[model samples]
Target: MHSDPSGSTDRIEKDIVINATRERVWSTLVTFFWVDEGNLGTIDPKAGDRFVAHSAKEGSFPITIEKADHPSLLSYRWASAQEGAEPGEGNSTLVEFTLTERQDGSTLLHVVESGFASLPSAMAERAVSDNTYGWEEQLDALKKSVEG
Candidate 1:
């Protein structure tokens, strides 16, 4: 977790070591976002690709791919304020996933979501708390999905 002195932005980060190859972990992440989430359409895994993630529980939010490095790093920005607003410094949060292959045929996956400070103080606090728990569950699910 990261916080600025001005409370303008906060970060939530979680990492997991998966007993699987980098390719497997990456594939699982793609599926988790595109399939299980049922929000992202056909992902091209390229920067500038625009997508939407919709869920009954989470609602719909627009996302823009910020960076894509095959089997290593993938990052996107999601609107955290308004549903259809463009993801940017003040209106959205950036989610980044980094995968590192280990010598033991496993991979370490790290996820960081930042930019909560742009939102209202109460909303930012709630999002941080909610996502803290959400990330934990999601990472556990990812580990199971990839390791099993």
Candidate 2:
């Protein structure tokens, strides 16, 4: 088990090691599992790029990519699913992925989701809980995606 944040988690994070290299994990994060658009549009094996996540859900705002550190880290702002941007409104949240290397040469992935503090209290809590669970699922998803 991992250490859970001991407080109001306006932000949440999780980590896991995959049986692969950082380069391979990078590919899976950019071109595969996560959506490609907006911030997640352009990603390379370096810093200073934006990676956005597109939405297939009706009215779900896209996550804006913010920063990256090659095969090590990627950060973005996650948008709200509830605040359906009608005409002009936009919802922005914080999201980040960090990759670490193990002595065994496997890859370790860490994910952090932030900025939900701005959401409505009820919604924020739900988003936190949901994502906490959601990331667990996705961590498994990514693990399988890369290891397979």
* Native-to-model Cα distance after best TM-score fit, residue 75 in candidate 2, in Å: 0.6
Flag regions of model 2 displaced more than 4 Å. Answer: 1-7, 32-59, 83-91
TM per candidate comes to 0.83, 0.73
Q: How far is candidate 1 from the true structure (C-alpha RMSD, Å)?
A: 3.3
lDDT of 2: 0.65
Q: Each model's RMSD to truth, in Å?
A: 3.3, 6.1
- Which 10-residue window of candidate 1 scores lowest in summed lDDT? 34-43
Evaluated at residue 98, the lDDT of candidate 2 is 87
Model 1 residue runs over 4 Å out of place are 1-9, 34-42, 81-85
Against the reference, the lDDT scores of all candidates come to: 0.77, 0.65
